[model samples]
Target: MKLLKGLWIGFWSGLILGLLLKWIQSVTGEQVYTLLLNVDFVPVIGSVQWSEITEFIFHMIIALVIGVVFVYVAKRRNYSFGQLVLISLLMSAPFPFLYFLLSWLAVEAEVPAATDWSAFLYWIFAHLTYALLLPILYKTFERKNAVSQ
Candidate 1:
């Protein structure tokens, strides 16, 4: 149940985050969206060109893992609201660094440059939005479950 709850939150949050990043890229002409779906760094998988939906599914799979871990930990720890909020923020805070890591690791992938400040800031905003939505989604799921129970 906890796992499912986490998956639910993760699915919605990831979808929203992906859309936000895609929109940002479209409007700003940044490569953030491309970065999000890029897998050119992966050795075996790098050889094949993936459709955007397939790449987005890869992203969602990661999101689902993150969600499951977060909810499992939260359930076990029984954290307070403030603590959950903090956890969400702390968990998401390092995401921007992932951009740099990907940029550094990318071979022929067209990702954002390591020093694109605007894209970095946009990435930060999109992640922060995800962080903010996590608790809300978790609580909503909890409430719905409670009512069902």
Candidate 2:
């Protein structure tokens, strides 16, 4: 039961977050913030233009793993909403941050010059946004879980 709830929350939260980030970039007319969007991974893989779909699924899987872990941990510790949010950010930020580092390092990467500051901030904001949403999702479903009990 708990595992199912975790998967539900994680999958949706990650999908929503990924979609939201993509939408923001589109709306802002900004250069791609996500490295995968700009990477020439095709020649390496040969004929696979499924980059967008693959990235989403990869991130969703990551979120699912985090969600499952969070639920199991919460079962023992019972963190408050704020603590959970912090934990979520802590768990979520590193993966993207590492990407940001790689993007910064990759000389051949078509990264935005503004990414040095602005896009990096948005990257942080995006992760923080994900963290904020996950707990809210948890609390919402938690209410449902409680009432059903």
TM-score of 2: 0.77
Which 10 successive residues of model 2 have the least lDDT summed? 38-47
Among residues 3 or more apart in sequence or in different chains, the pairs in candidate 1 whose N, CA or C atoms overlap within 3 Å are none
- What's each prediction's TM-score? 0.94, 0.77
Question: What is the alpha-carbon lDDT of model 2 when measured against the actual structure?
Answer: 0.68
Q: Candidate 1, residue 55: CA error in Å? A: 0.5
lDDT of 2 at 125: 71
lDDT of 2 by residue, 1-149 (tens): 88998898888788777877787677764444465344344356324455678756766887898777777766667789888787777777675665556566544546555346666665667667777877888878888989999
Top candidate when judged by lDDT against the true structure = 1
Cα misplacement distance, residue 9 of candidate 1 (Å): 0.9
Residue 84 error for model 1, in Å? 0.4
Candidate 1: C-alpha RMSD to true structure equals: 1.2
Q: Model 1, 67: alpha-carbon shift in Å?
A: 0.6
User: Model 1 compared with the native: what TM-score?
Assistant: 0.94
Supply the global lDDT for candidate 1. 0.88
